[model samples]
Target: MAEARAELQKKETELTNAILKDVSDIVDAIGYEGGYAVILRSEVVLSAKKELDITGAVIRRLNESKGKPKEAPKVKPKEKPKDKK
Candidate 1:
């Protein structure tokens, strides 16, 4: 049971990291395209101009791109270490 729980936790963490990465990628692209100097999270900011907020734009972009294909990261196989006799 513990092993299963650990596996589930691991999977959850992977999913979270992947999701965050995708969102971060989108945010970075938006920032670059919009010529934004910086983008702040709502949780961290006490106040900001409404025009500076890009949360809605990000959400809209995500939604619009849903069902579209994304390129998978290419991973190289790890090579075995050479053994010294």
Candidate 2:
């Protein structure tokens, strides 16, 4: 159980890191294209003007890059053991 839990956690971490890296790359591109001097996360700042926020643009770009979602792989169910008397 512990081993399975650890493996799941590792996979989750890897997936999260990959997603963050992709977002960072997209944001960097947006900044370069928009001539932004600096971009800060909303969490880091107390408040910022809506006009300064490029989150919508970033999301739109991300969606465009992603295109259509791929179908997930199908998993087969395990069979129950049969007992013979």
Steric overlap count per candidate:
0, 0
Off by over 4 Å in 1: 68-85
> Please, what are the lDDT tens digits per residue for candidate 1 over residues 21-73?
87898899999999989888899999888989898988878777676678999
Assess every candidate by TM-score. 0.72, 0.76
RMSD of each: 13.7, 3.7
Q: Write the per-residue lDDT of candidate 2 for residues 1-85, one digit (tens) a residue.
A: 9999999999999999988888999999999999999999999989889999999998888888889788999999999999988
TM-score of 2: 0.76
